[model samples]
Target: MGELQVEKHVKYILAVEKRKDDFESVVMEHLRLNGAYWGLTTLDILGKLDAVDQDEVISWVMQCQHEDDIAGLQNEDGSFSGDMWGEVDTRFSYIAICSLALMRQLDKIDVGNAVKYIVSCKNVDGGFGCTPGAESHAGQIFCCVGALAITGSLHHVDKDLLGWWLCERQVKSGGLNGRPEKLPDVCYSWWVLSSLILIDRVHWIDKEKLAKFILDCQDKERGGISDRPDDAVDVFHTYFGVAGLSLLEYPGLKPIDPAYALPVSVVSKVILGK
Candidate 1:
């Protein structure tokens, strides 16, 4: 089952390569930093970074920058633009930073403007929103925290309030939600837990229940993970499933540094500031 699942993921990667022009077409069609980041990061995680031209990728990602400081923009409709057509959101910003850092283009980013954009996303609740004036969500908070961490500006966030918001995500099912009144899901387990780890307050939540919920979301027979128990499995949830387990220090699973939210093997080199 495990090998088959691995093969499925491998085929996804191969498909991305076999249709490189199509992939690039989609990327260019969006032409946003975050979208470019998503494409590059997906390739990077798959060990296919060389499949795309580093310089072209770097240049395209750079085009999404507003000056050197801010990395994303608002779409014409103002709905949280990205390389897609919407206003900027914290999640994409996180992806953009990580993608650039992974590509070793950290030096080219305008740290200050990026910080400004991150700061702008902060809400009165002490947590961050996807965009200015939006409600605070666990996912967006992760992006905000992650972007700041990459740029060495994590201190700009209000940790106490952010921690409180993250802890509130835990529900009776041992799962976490992205926002208030949302259903518990496995993906948020990583989003919320990683945020807690970032602020060193993971202990405030129910760890045992959270871990159980995550495990239950795994497709033991299929060797992948779903957003919730009995849900359809996909790559996004599968990656987060492994990530959440790593956050809990699960035995036999690789550890993930919540601060960088990448596998320890990859995050360690990033932390070394290389």
Candidate 2:
């Protein structure tokens, strides 16, 4: 079996960020904040976070948050928009909270309102959706669960029901799908698996099989992971793949917190001031 191309993967991530005019960067401009988090967290997990300029990253992150508009983003009903377009989603809630938490600026927003908005997205099936009344999806569920975890509002989650729904995402291929009838993908390995682990129900899934599935999706030559075997690789899937392995406690990789989605040491320093 081929091993993770640790050095090559790190170089690939750094290169992607530097190529601002590239197709991937252009396409991801709208969600640059989310991309930064993924890349930075991955670097941290690989023990190479120091490769980037810390002050520069923090400054760019603050600009993305737009401190002046923080209060305005919270709707009267508590939902948040990914941008000024006003399309509310639980995913934005997670992104906002996770980003702020990493920067140690969580106090800028109303935690109570944010948590309430996410709770409003919770469905009767014990899952969460992009917005109230929307159908639940694994991606949205991870966002909701992750946001709640960051805010210490996990009480809003129906652990048993959500856990059942999440574990059900695991398919015969040992890979997980985003929803019912969807094909299995490596990305869900992070989304569904992390949510399940957070609710203390990860034991319900086949960890060994899931690990193998993620490993099989890796590009042994180029050093990035794909959504599935023999597919093209990208930074997004690469982060998720490595993160999923971290969650599974794969040897030689850093351990990641299911909720915070950062290495335990980084989460501790950010949350605990250690």
Candidate 3:
């Protein structure tokens, strides 16, 4: 029954922008990643991009060809590592593929093998995991499905099965949890909803109820969203909350491409060079 505090949310996001020379707060560093995804995507989606701090937006046209070490992250089996330290996960696959795709250099990596690696992480329960033989989870499903969608390889997913798995994440309160028997969290609205949308199964969930749930988690007066109502608000959950509302077709918000996790218009420019 609550409404999205659009102006308040925008102010909250802008209020948290990391000042120059700030390197101590881990929380600030997080929302600032990916050229301040929280600020850019939220501002862009909310039609408030004019309020963005241009210098805070780092549009890196990173070199990822063999010259830049994207290939080095790939293992023989095709999964990618988070970095030189070699920690592997479907999360890394999404990060690597999404990064390269935005750079217009997806071909620099082995697409066929990358798809194979992501597919291997799929479980019979119809959801994806962090690694092969790992437990299925909503966040992992988002990463794997997003990677597959970006690469034009979604056929590798079992849509019907995965859709059912994702559907079960919604609790009686209308909020979604990451996995079975877990408490619902605002973040899953982005994870589970985006994955369902990518597979053409978004309608299976209760849109109105989920939207109400997300709205209920917002700090309406101060402008930020939390994982649950009555909890502390942070930019991370605010990012997911606003992005989820966009996916739900909330009025006055722009559409975001579920796969790229960017405003749809921005994705066209980033990937298609439009």
Candidate 4:
């Protein structure tokens, strides 16, 4: 029942960014672009985005793209690879597009083809997968749906059917899982909840119970959230936990756009060209 330690969470995120050579950073180096989005979005939601140097962060983001590792990761079909190994996934497409869009550099990619590829991953169940014919999963669904939303291609989604599927992820625990028959995790709070809101089906699930689940996972002592209560905490879950609360209209927190996963203010400036 304790309050969210906004300052402590902010410090944790900042510390993660500052320790460039740490074990966690080393492991996250492969997807630093996505990590940046998560951290930056969390900061903005907490109303502390100005704490970092905008120009410096944007420069690093651009460099992360142009570097030989991530460059040319895009396939002919518009799918993106996570690294030089060239494994394509809808998740990469979402991360890359989101990062560039936030930096006001969407012109750098073939957005039309990107949308086309995501559409290719659509399933008859009104859900999307990592690639064509892959079974629909909540995590992949979020990435695909989010990318489509950012690009104004939401018309591609079948709101009712998809909403039904996403809403079904909620279990008796009031927590949501990535797919049926799986244990609900706190991270899905963002994935499932955001997808429902985007499709206008949020009312299908029990928001009150879900909020309580996320709150229970918070480490009131250490100031971060975990995937489940009484478990170890990390920055990733911490961001999702807070973002989920933001979606739930928790007081004292900035509103987060379900699709872009960024603060309403930052999304407006970056995507709306305001």
Candidate 5:
């Protein structure tokens, strides 16, 4: 496979944001805030974050959250809902923490309660679920573990056990699947790889093969990446593909913090106060 189409991928992400009437954009309207974060994070990883208006983007995020949509939406159990309706998930908890951490405002919410809620979602098998008593999933594990890491609470995680579970997500194809017996997908590269890195078990997976797997999913001529090879490319998979490459220490790409899911430069400046 050829190299990552960095310029093409950047163009694809920027174009998606402009094409408001497109299927992806329209359907993802309710998740506008999170979409902004993902897209911007992707751009940041590509070293093109300054291509957009930072002030305008910050203003837009503030406008999206009010009394209901984000703030005060945390449940009594300390988990967060994706929106005002209040459906809780560790995914939302991660998004909430990541977003707030980016804004330098993690203090606005009950961080203590959020950590407790995330810990409660941990399964005995050393994985995290979407919620308490739910089945462990790689995606949810990433979310919960990421939240805990950002809050400086890795002491709550059983690293050896969770690392074993995460490392097992890798399949024969060199790509990672979200759960056992599932076909490997490019998206899980970011989820699983990041989780493994956070828990210090990234060496458990075959990095070279994984790098090739993500590269093979790229649409060589058109840019963007798909969930798997010979499949339709989408912005979601494209972001993960590039991010996964970053995690693999791919040449010519920025390093991303596994826990924060942002560029090391940005994270150092914003979260780490460097």
Candidate 6:
């Protein structure tokens, strides 16, 4: 099944690479941390990282870093402001860090200042915000937690409060919401579940129901998951949908390392330099 998924991903990457779309163009220009992370992740899964210029790609990714000590930014502007808390988001920061780590350039980053920025994003509500002084969100919480875990600063987080906030994200349907009042979605299943896994609190959530809800979001005939029931299927949700289920130890899915946010299969190869 892993081999088949890799083949499917290779074909998908080929098709996407051939497209004359804005997605590819934007990724090249911005090297947006998330986009690069996704691209490299998929390629790594397919054992095709050599197809990309590792050095050039790493250089571009570093350029996206904000001099203001934030990890990812909406634009190259160093203004330290934006709609989502007027600063770089912790979510983007996690992706940026992961991307560099995948490329073995994690040492190039200012770990101390990056940790400071991530710490500042933590909200009193227990979850981390996209930026300082923003509302707590599940997605950003995953970012902050994932970042801290990767940087070996997990001890800095308030584990009790963070776990409480994550548990609060669960809804009757077993899906999770980014914020207090938003509707539950499959994406948060990844955010919240991953956070729980990192904090050793996975057993605290209803894994059975969460797995059912995530499966329900799948397009049975189409073979991909959507963000919500009846929504169009896309790559983003597809990846997280599988990942969310993987977290619950779903029978046929690969196990994802919550701390690094990568499938154990791929991470093993990375760590071993295989």
- What is the C-alpha local distance difference test score of each model? 0.68, 0.86, 0.87, 0.87, 0.87, 0.70
TM-score result, candidate 6? 0.72
| Candidate 5 per-residue C-alpha lDDT over 1-274 given as tens digits, one digit per residue, 9 for 90 to 100 | 4588888888877877788887867888987776687788889888888888899989888886566435467888898998867788889999898888888888889999999999999999999999899999999999998999899998899999999888888887799999999999998999999988888889988999899999999888777889999999877788888899999988888999898887898789986689
* TM-score against native, each model: 0.70, 0.88, 0.91, 0.85, 0.89, 0.72
Off by over 4 Å in 6: 1-87
Summed over model 1, clashes come to 12
Q: Judged by TM-score relative to the true structure, which candidate is superior, 2 or 4?
A: 2
Per-residue lDDT of candidate 4, residues 144-163 (tens digit) = 99999889989989999999
Kindly report which residue pairs in candidate 3 clash with one another. Answer: none
| True-structure RMSD for candidate 2 | 2.5
Descending-TM-score candidate ranking: 3, 5, 2, 4, 6, 1
List residue ranges in candidate 2 displaced over 4 A: 21-24, 31-33, 53-67, 100-110
lDDT of 5: 0.87
Tens digits of per-residue lDDT for model 3 on 149-249? 99899988989999999999999889999999999999999999999999999989999999999999999789999999989987778889989999999
* Model 2: how far residue 150 lies from native, Å: 2.2
When 1 and 4 are scored with TM-score, the better candidate is 4
Deviation from native of the Cα of residue 212 in model 5, angstroms: 0.4
State model 3's lDDT. 0.87
Estimate the TM-score for candidate 5.
Answer: 0.89
The local lDDT score (0 to 100) that residue 95 gets in candidate 2 is 78
